[model samples]
Target: MSENKNKSGVGMKRSGGMGGGPMGSFAGPIVKAKDFKGTLKRLLGYLKPQRVKFIIVFIFAIMSTIFTIVGPKISGNAITRLVEGMIAKYTAISQNTALLKSGKDAVIPIPSIDFPYIGNIILLLLGLYLISALFGFLQQYIMAGVAQKTVYNLRKEVEDKLSRLPLKFFDARTHGEILSRVTNDVDNISTTLQQSLTQLITSIVTIIGVIIMMLTISPLMTLVVILTLPLYVAITAFVAKHSQKYFAAQQKEIGELNGHVEEMYTGHKIIKAFGREHDSIKKFENINDRLYNAGWKAQFISGIIMPMMRFVSNIGYVVVCVAGGYLATQGRISIGDIQAFIQYSSQFTQPIVQTANIANIIQSTVASAERVFELLDEIEELPDTTNAKLIEFPKGEVKFENVDFSYKSEESLIKNMNIDVKQGHTIAIVGPTGAGKTTLVNLLMRFYEIGAGSITIDGVDIRDIKRGELHNMFGMVLQDTWLFNGTIMENIAYGKKGATEEEVMKAARAAHAHHFIKTLPDGYNTILNEEASNISQGQKQLLTIARAILANPTIMILDEATSSVDSRTEVYIQRAMTELMQNRTSFVIAHRLSTIRDAELILVMNKGSIIEMGNHNELLDKNGFYADLYNSQFTGANLDNEVI
Candidate 1:
């Protein structure tokens, strides 16, 4: 099953896994960056190339906000003009009425409202608003491009870094954890840059512009509005401080839930076979319950922010209204100015709230940037030697002299191991689990650098050769087959670049996979799903063998290739192996002793050293470790436990 599919077969998607709600970014848990200043500086470095676009964005954002900020005041002026006109007309009417009552011949002309002036003001306001919208759109468009490009470069660097990193790096981390950094963390940065960054600039500009406009109208009213700032900050801080832990808990629970879903979905077959579905469901319910508790608490706490802000804002509004009304009555402020002041007061609180929310979002974004940077900063594999050697035609002769290696520096696994493999010789290695059977092949392939030794191929040190060229010398078909989501023909042809249809079919026939290919509905064109579960295990193994056969390298590695198949399938695979190994140096690691009876050399390994080396008949005559191990297969003795 796809990891994206939840237990109920529903698709589950997360944005940064921060447990944010419908309120968008405002409801997420805040994640503080460990090195805020440093990480922020580094993140800004990615924007340096797009500094021109960002500068334009800044200018456009400020211009858009300024036009909007001045609108309320201008509209207020129009209101004052209308009010003054009405008063003048009323006064004129009263005078005319007095004259008529006193029987006077003359009468005052009643003043008409200046509709043209009001019309002009309305038109000016419309123009300003339209210009503001245009600027806003341009800035957003430019910013989106900049954000995408910056993230593109960052993602690319991370991908390139992964290729350079040693295998141990991957071995030490879970696939999901690494994937989260690549997918989720990178996506978070992209979202912040695209949306929050522009909003942040506009918000700050709005707050400053609103304040300036309010002060111009009435400093007293401005002061009243300003007094409410501390309350907003206090409420925001209080809620954020208390909600931080719950948000953190929520994020943790989300990760656990995702991990559990992924693990169960991938191994669902095993769980069902073992009849653990009930236990799985119970465990899932337990995780879901914890997630619910953490999620609601985080949301409820963060959710109160806007309501609390509104409450404080209303208090400020009332005080400003009272103050503005008094100023207007004293003729210290115009009625229009008072109205604009109220609008400014209302506008003031919004940007402050947005700014606070953006601050939290920026913190989370920086934390995500830190994770991606960490991956980029991981120690990579040692660079190949300068002027690396390349063999045009490899002879398959291999020698391991005084090889010493270990996964960890504190404990040694292979110590001063030595071996010589002639061209076209078959070497069969038999050992218990953790007995260094696979480690020997790993050293030969230079998967890990030997602590102290020299491994040479055809008299050239493998280290001296280019890593790519060295890898090209061998073809490996492991017990665990790996086939991607592609046509079977494509999978088989993966071993040889630009392989033709005929070449692929020839390799498949040699591996005895052609018969199965013909039986499938689409034949060689049949597509394998992501896990390749559509085909049987034995069939998957045969496809891998076909791929290896297509490569036709000088050396072959058959690592327990037939270990997982049934007896009947094993016979078919063994026949394919015989043909593949006819004229090539091959290393076969097997648990079953009977499979390697025809091998030129059979090495019995224990702990980290070769305990005995000989042909099957010679080892059996000697009746030593190899003899005991070989005899135990038929005798039904637990040789692995007893011998180790």
Candidate 2:
């Protein structure tokens, strides 16, 4: 029942892992990888198939950065030509003025500025920027395809891994936690690969290219710019180290808050019935407060990175300007060279900042990758035998011989159990809450492997039959009905593939569900929501019963199948089940002893062992555990809470 509640949206929110915050903020909480190098190497393996595309991306990225980097140097040269041309004109005019003032009857010719040369430089600069932009577009376009394909393959593998995993694996984790890995974590990896990885490549290329250009203009100014690298590294490392815990806390709090809300929403009726709205609100507020503290502190600390980098950058600018002015005055560097070196310096710092930002993003991405890998690494169900057998025509005769089973190695449950049921027998199993009633059915269906001995159908070991073939021999209607978002006809037809409309309607009539289904506005076409909560609980059970009837399996397992319906509806369901179970094997787990009195054989189980086995009247005559249980049900006692 708790598992059913969880499935109804208890812990199913997709918390987008980490580093999701305000826009334009370079800093996000970093999630460090447990095995950073190993995870990264594995993540890169996904890209190996796209190696050619990646090489093209790298080449385009470098080409684009190189073109942009050379622009500043070329513009600087234009500045030098303009400055020299202006000076030459000024000197010529001064000499002519002096000669005219001296009355020498001679006038020197003044030179004109070289506007054509400067125009050509402007056109050249425009061409360089245009080419750079084109290359950048291509790089991004190629990288996007590579990233999407890689993520697609990854998602496919995770889905396949999930199918192969055993039921116990899902039993141990919350739906939300597993969903986070599949959706949010995988999305995180996708975002990084598509955006951050390309940005990392370009930033590194820009940094290297800008440094070479700056060196060509002035090594002294390049050295001054390089000196700020240590400060940038120190500031980023300090803030990242200090803010790491807060970001982790922020992520944890977000998950808790989402979980609380999901729980409250799904169980809102129960909470209101119990008058615990105040308690729920208090818990929500407490989680919200912790989230607020962690969020702001993380944002504030990581937010310090950009401004500190900018401040350090400004200081570098001031030193470079002063040094460049002196060098220009000494005729060691031209005016245009000074201008280009300043541009190169600014370009250099920007990529460094971007590289640092991408570093944080990559860390979070690798952490997401590690989580996905962990899911992929989980132990899967044991494979079927190589020479598996099939039951061409099943008789539904089942026997459990010297069987032993336990969920845990240290504890024994259902030890040395044995049962024999001929075809067409209705076997009713009654027990306390934890008496392994459901476990017995699960083992019979091969939902779990037995620890010892064997379970066979028609003299053949169940393990020898392929699981799919074995499952086709039985039908089940559990107490907690599962219905996906679909029309009534579709839901019913899910039991038997290629079932026609006439067949579905026939099954619905047998389960006594057709009358109510016809009353709905859309009748058989009415769509169920995700939770299938649009209909009453009894109606949902009827639909599941209709589905099972359509299957017409050789064996049936009913686990409290009629527990959710009202007495009237339960009578209809009981009639339907009786007809369905006629001349076929059936195992019914029931708490209401009245329902199973007509069963061919009754098995009274306590502490995982069958204490009594006989017909209803024989058990009553014996006056043993089965008789006591039957009498207690009439005395209005809760059998689930009874110890004996």
Candidate 3:
């Protein structure tokens, strides 16, 4: 399965691996990142460009919070004024005379209720809120831009990294594992940056500002807030520490589940053919149950933080309320300041509640950030030398000079292999599976560099040639054909950049594909489904051949190109291959010896050595490994003759 399915463009590598495993690794509880702080610091480095914008946002956030903080104090003053005015009015009416304005130092006995004063104060309060709202809106708007731009760049970086990653990376991991990093992990970072980042900043500022406001109002009341602080810290720390593991476990299970689903969906035909639907369902149930256990545990654990914080906060609120009322009676604090201080204390706990909630979010974000960074830190393919020359025109004179290689150091697969092919010569490589045929192809193509010596093209070391120019010299038709979900014409045209319709038709005719293609519902305009499953395997192979033919390269690689076709169709394909290989160097890797019997040079390989080399008759007379392989195809006839 491929991590990313071939869309129109981008991320086009084929993925490898089966899904699921025993109860270990992913099944184990989630562990912390090895360098949590480093991962977070690196994650923030992506947003470094938005530093100035964030600063502005921070300033606006503080303005909004400060405005909100003072609103309660103003409200308290308005209430106090109302009480004093009502008392003075009652006193004046009892004296049976018009209320008089007293001296500057004396109290003003109210003649009428001070409605205008209260209204003015109310308007002032509204004005402060309006300013807060304006700044708050600006803060969110700026952060939104900052968050989006940051993730956009991060996505681009990951895409570029995927393109540079070595094949070995894909070989070791599943499509699900890679896809999880791209989709789930990147998305987690995106969500945290966009939603939680601004909220976190605001929460911290609000907590600090509220603390200062409460202290300024009354030191005695501040002590009450201080008393309840330890309980809040203890509850938050304990719950957060325990919930972190479950959140990490949840992410891992989700990846496993995704991997299993992608595997099952792509291989449903094979599963049904084998009548393993029940077994597949059972496997799915196992994964799904694990996910449920991990997910709910994470959710349940994080779920307790808010309620627990609210419980702790409520207890503090009750204590402050009692303390404030008593202080008001003792005249140590005015009723207005007492009211303001209580409101300050209430707002203070909210940010604490928010911070606690954000801590759980941060736990998940860190787990995901670590996954994303791992992909970013993957070892890239060695870069080409700065002065690597471009292959202006390839002559197709290829040589493997004492080349040695292995997928691992302990196990040598190919050793001291040497072969030479002149320009325009046809070289047929015949071997069984795992005989290093594909490995040899990969070396020649520079997909895997030789461990010793060199593979050269036209006397130029391939490593010294730029990879893009090297690839352009050859056309390939592999055993497994790849066709995107597009019209048949588009798939055929993919081999050559901007190929004309006439050229596509001509190539198709040469490959004997034009006849069947014309018989289809819409001819070349027919759209292939994903996986090209709507067409037969032979038809897909024919399309791939047509694509390679359209390229008109100086070198060709055909890896079992006709294996899927019937004998009748194979004849046409062989003829097409003969014509395509004319005056061009071609490397044909085939298991069927009969197809390549007429080749100019046959390199018969077993294990990784060319044990026999000759034309058909020459190899047959040798009676070596090559002859035995060719003769084994007719064992039934031999058995019949012996019995007679």
- The top-ranked prediction according to TM-score is 1
What is the C-alpha lDDT profile of model 1 across 1-644, one tens digit per residue? 33332322211123352446533455565566799999999999999999999999999999998999999999999999999999999999888888888999546888899999999999999999999999999999999999999999999999999988887898877665678788878999999999999999999999889988887887778888898889988887788777777776776666678768888987989999999999999999998999899988888887887788789988988898888888888999998898888898888888887887788788888988988899999998878999898889898998989988899999889888888989999999998889998888888888777899999999999989988898899999998999999999999999999999999999999888899899999999999999999999989999999999999999999898887678887888788888889879999999888889999998888888888888999999998888778777878675664543
Give the higher-lDDT candidate: 1 or 2: 2
For candidate 3, write residues 193-282 as lDDT tens digits: 777877888899888877787887787778888788898888766765666566556555665666677778989899999999999899
lDDT of each: 0.86, 0.86, 0.79
Ranking by TM-score: 1, 2, 3
How many pairs of residues collide in model 1?
Answer: 0
**Best candidate according to lDDT:** 2
lDDT of 2 at 333: 92
Clashes of each: 0, 0, 0
Query: How does each model score on TM-score?
Result: 0.93, 0.93, 0.85
RMSD of each: 3.1, 3.0, 6.5
